[model samples]
Target: MNGVITPADTLGTRLTGLRGFYRAGYRSVLAYRADLLFGVIGFVIQTVLAVAVWRVLYDGHDEVAGVASSTAVAYAVLAGCIQSVVMPWQFSSLPQRVFRGQIGVDMMRPRSLISQNLAQAAGTMVGRLPIGVAGLAVGLALGGVQAPRSLLDLFASAVSILLGIANIMTINLLVSMIAFWTLETGGVMILYRFASAFLSGALIPLWFMPEWLQPIIGRLPFQAQIYAPLSIWFGTRHGGELIGTLALQLGWVLALFVLLQLVWRRAVHRVVVLGG
Candidate 1:
């Protein structure tokens, strides 16, 4: 049973397993209604602060760092909305899963362990989507997200948003596998998030940064994950540039998954996270 499993066999088994795992993750998140409520509350508070920041900057300059007033507000609203689309509920959750021995159990599966976890993590995203959608609608209505003038633009926006999520989920699975070697999950999570927020245009739009910072920021993959897509919707980057942005996102998704396979193999061979 061990050697050279066929691709067809591998796929069929994985699909069945993932379906169950995904549902379980959904149920698990829903069971903790308090957490979802608190998350919503926090998001609301953050949205208000973000809107205030953008408004002040826009008022001062007519354009905040060369970005239109409407675009800046949309950025803030999208940042809030995008928060729920990402995977890895909390950075520490991965280490906690390992410390409790879930990693070992996950490793025992016939399918790619990363896919299994990702599918489950996706469920959590789906669970949060409804409330997050409603919240984003409310925030945008109050804060003013620029509406797409055309159906094509709207469709593109939706595609970019989902692909952005896919790109994020891929990166976090790679990050989570770090629980295999070091107990410093907090540090890894913090660094990953900080880099993403700042460079990815969530914390501040790249337009707001000095010219010197813009080049440095553009080179990083972080920008491609979220801001690049959002930029397309904002019409800051259009057509081929937008297509290229999505290509980069897909590229990252593939590259990160391959890199994660290597890490998972090594961690499975060496690390011993008891019970998790």
Candidate 2:
């Protein structure tokens, strides 16, 4: 068996390589600490402004769509924090790589492209933690935010947030893959930003949305990314409902994974045909 790698050994090696990629991603983010700090400051400002707007809207009302004004403020804060941490908009470098003719070199690497990108995304999320925590603290200080109703709710929120981050990353990967054919993804990126902000409930909770629109938005992956987790934190979703929501998030993650694979294969074929 000397100098021979078994299947298990190969799997272990690949896992180790992926871990390295994750660490590299984390380090890269850390290297831009100043930029991250600025981002945190901007995020805190945005969260505060959002909280103020919602507070004003609910000034004369106890609740809107069964959610208290205070709860809405909390949701706004938490949603902003999640967005800043995951920062899905920044996840995809594939477009730039394609534009610069560097994607060919990336494709030549032995690593699985999806796994490597996922690792990097995981790293970026890790790197954003300090900023996220700071932003959350600021949101709390600004008032109108509430603590999780119970330990269980808190746990559920945490789990949902992790799933949400995964969902966001998958969506970003899918969007970036479009570069394989178009080679210019600026418009697509802009469209994704607007769509995600609205549909993900970052700007407004789905509960406040039109009743007819609620069902449609609920079924979308965007809701899984932000709304579901925030709902868990706000105690709006619980027990079987909480379980169902988390299940939906998991389903989206799996579905997106399969879709990414299919799209990546076609993208690679396109790249090859274009002489990449």
Candidate 3:
């Protein structure tokens, strides 16, 4: 009988699975070129609307809402370009698979379940990144806009985006695992999306939010996802503030990853969809 697997065998299996998943995810949006084209067109329309809004607010003065006109444009433009195309899809399929037992087979695979899914998500994001980069270029050209002034600002913005994605993945993976314990993940995903939409500065900038809510909502991990990154891109943050933001992001990443490992252990102990 086949008693067990070796380290080399396990590593090979995981790599093969990762490659397969990556290719499958890569081919996803290609199946719908029309949708991809429409997505780009939609970003263009959004760019127009944002410029119109900026004009109304910045009529006589170059600044409004406590931020410069150019910075505002960068925020709006990036939000429109990135969120419209690369924003996370809060899919509730993980929960459905758990309850319906579709994930049973997936669990039996040698690779970690969440790791496999993360690989798929990472590949999908990469697949979409080129299109998003193109849209960003088109947006900047269409509006002829410039971002923050300093090299520091550009660096801050890029760091924010990278860390923000890491944080998002950490949070989403944790949420996905929730399905293992609770089947009612629709409400969970809905709540998560609502929080992201309202708090993350995806649609509205944080400065526009009510002052009182800032202290409370600001601490939430969702804000770090969109606002902090966009702020750096706009050069709104500097010095000590930048360090604090990055620290917070690192803290959450570490915390969530730890929680995820614990959750996986408990989940598998309770129910191994694959034979142990």
Candidate 4:
């Protein structure tokens, strides 16, 4: 009985392994203190600049597309901070490791590769949380970020944010898994980041986009990543509309996770080592 492991033990072991990956990922970000400092400074500057740009756009108008100028400014500030924390720029290190023949080591680990990667990504996001918080503080000081319209709005936004984070991590994981076939994804990763920024509404809100394009973007998973939660926070989405948006986010997260599994199965077989 002592030598035999129980199901609960097995589960605990697996969770412990995942936590190791999370801590490693988190510490890696904090290892370079200078980078952390500069990163926060850069993000603060970016948030402020984005806020200023939105203000300029709304210079002579009280509202555009039924969204008040103040709302737009707050959206920009929060969007920038959210984008900073989401950190879509790097996407994942999978493609690079694959190209370098290091993925074989990852595959050899006892845990599932996808779970490990997601845990690491979550760690990295947590590590960068301070930067987002600092940017929000700046926004608050500048009067660019306002309180939620109501407590319900706050609660709904919080749930949507979690879903949005899952949607983002899953989508990015799918992108990273592309390395199994391509072996190198520098150009593709860059392109994906650019497209995500626009489509996710981090660069420009859907309200400001062309009339015909708004609904189309709304249907995409990218919108669920940043726009949906922020819109909920802004009180633009509520009632049945809020429920629908959250449902869509959950749907995309589930669908993307399924797609990730399919891709991962093929990806594992395609791993390339440095030598025979």
Ranked by TM-score, top first? 4, 2, 1, 3
Report the alpha-carbon TM-score of model 3 versus the true structure: 0.83
Give TM per candidate. Answer: 0.86, 0.92, 0.83, 0.94
Candidate that scores best on lDDT: 4
> For residues 11-77, what per-residue lDDT tens digits would candidate 2 score against the true structure?
9988888897789778877898898778778877787788888889899999887888888888888
How many residue pairs clash in all the candidates, one count each?
8, 0, 0, 0
Better-scoring candidate (TM-score), 1 or 3: 1
- Higher-lDDT candidate among 2 and 4? 4
What residue pairs clash in candidate 3, if any at all?
none
Residue 168 miss distance in model 3 (angstroms): 1.2
Query: Ten residues in a row with the worst lDDT in model 4?
Result: 267-276
Best candidate (score: TM-score): 4
Tens-digit lDDT track of model 3 for 137-182: 8767766367667888888778888887877777777777777777
Give the Cα lDDT of each candidate. 0.72, 0.86, 0.73, 0.87
